[model samples]
Target: MFKNIKSTKTLVKKSLTIFLLAMTAVMFSSVAMSVQSLRGDSALDSKANKAGKHKIDTVEGGIERNFELQPPMIPHTIDKYRISLKGNGCMKCHSEKAYKKEKAPKVGDSHYVTRDGKTLKTISSRRYFCTQCHAPQTKDNPLVDNVYEGI
Candidate 1:
């Protein structure tokens, strides 16, 4: 009985060691793959060298909403927007007080409501970040055909 107990302990130790070694090997291989895959120029760093001087489309009206839930595309250039953790430059034009004066559309009332349905005077923290949903429009044509039509 004592011999059997010792053998069982040894088997458990061997299994645990093998499992730990396999986990270590998997972690190292994943880290190596991630490092190798990201070793290239990022897409954003590549400028429009072929598409002439990259200019923001500043046409007066905004583009059509792509689908039912699509956020409106930015109508004007936002290259100078200081959208950061410290301050939101977009609020200068889109905030309640400034929207009327600037003729820019006010932020939606939903922005002031919490997920639990409580309404607040200020934009909820979840919606405080504007560009999270809205994106600036690019002049480039779609890479693939968009067959979607909004209702």
Candidate 2:
């Protein structure tokens, strides 16, 4: 009638310019296929891409606590132990006057508190760095699935 409303307004402006040029060619082809898959190749290394050297697991005894304030895995063999910044050889048998004459295993009471909870009598220069939260248990197994059901 007015030339069918100017051909239905040029068919809704050519269907909204072909749906905005097919959504700008699918948003620039998904950012050019995410910058061509992040320019391909890149996995560096560090035993994660495994190839050779990675055998250092001989620490006999301790490895149990995986919860309840978990931090007890030294077992033995700290290879030439020396927690640096001067000395510490694991406080020569877990300090507390050398854990009952080096029978070992003392140094608890939360290592004498202090990180604002303040209960120090000793061992708290921010817990005098004992491998920054104990670790050394190796013999590897469970690199992933842990389930962890503890309190």
Candidate 3:
């Protein structure tokens, strides 16, 4: 009877060991299949691969804003347009004078208002640099999963 108890104890110990080992293997396998970075298999410290070059395109209407009060993005390529202190090439089409004839959207009325709340005939100096708030649009896929839902 003592021998029988001893053998049962050994059997239970072996079963428990096997169960623990199986659980450990499952945990490791699940972790190995976890999320990876957009940089493919590159290490976090390594430099990311060069992104594919794509032509800048113009949306028929415009890109929808992701959130309220979001700055509008440039739909067309701005590679040739100059935004220097000398002159603004964008004004040729977006300014009030040219928008009517060029069939382009006019600059926002807010651009003519000063920081002091005074209105001006032309774009205020504070809003003169268009690129500061607007970025050229791209169709590139997001580098990682984004769960951001803007209101």
Alpha-carbon TM-score of each model against the true structure: 0.61, 0.23, 0.65
Per-model clash counts, in order, read: 0, 0, 0
Candidate number with greatest TM-score: 3
Best by lDDT: 3
**All models: lDDT?**
0.78, 0.72, 0.84
Model 3 misplaced regions, further than 4 Å: 1-51
Cα lDDT tens digits for candidate 2, 2-61: 999999999999999999999999989876555522213334342243233334555445
Residue-level lDDT for 119 in candidate 2: 83
Q: Candidate 3 lDDT, tens digit per residue, 77-148? A: 998889899999888899988999988889889989999999999889988899999888677665546998
Model 2 alpha-carbon drift over 4 Å, by segment: 1-65, 72-77, 82-87, 91-109, 113-118, 124-135, 141-151
Q: Is candidate 1 or candidate 2 better by TM-score?
A: 1
Ranking by TM-score: 3, 1, 2
Model 3 residue 52 CA deviation (Å) reads 3.7
TM-score of 2: 0.23
Worst 10 residues of 1 by lDDT: 35-44
- Itemize residue pairs with steric clashes in candidate 2: none
Decreasing lDDT order of the candidates: 3, 1, 2
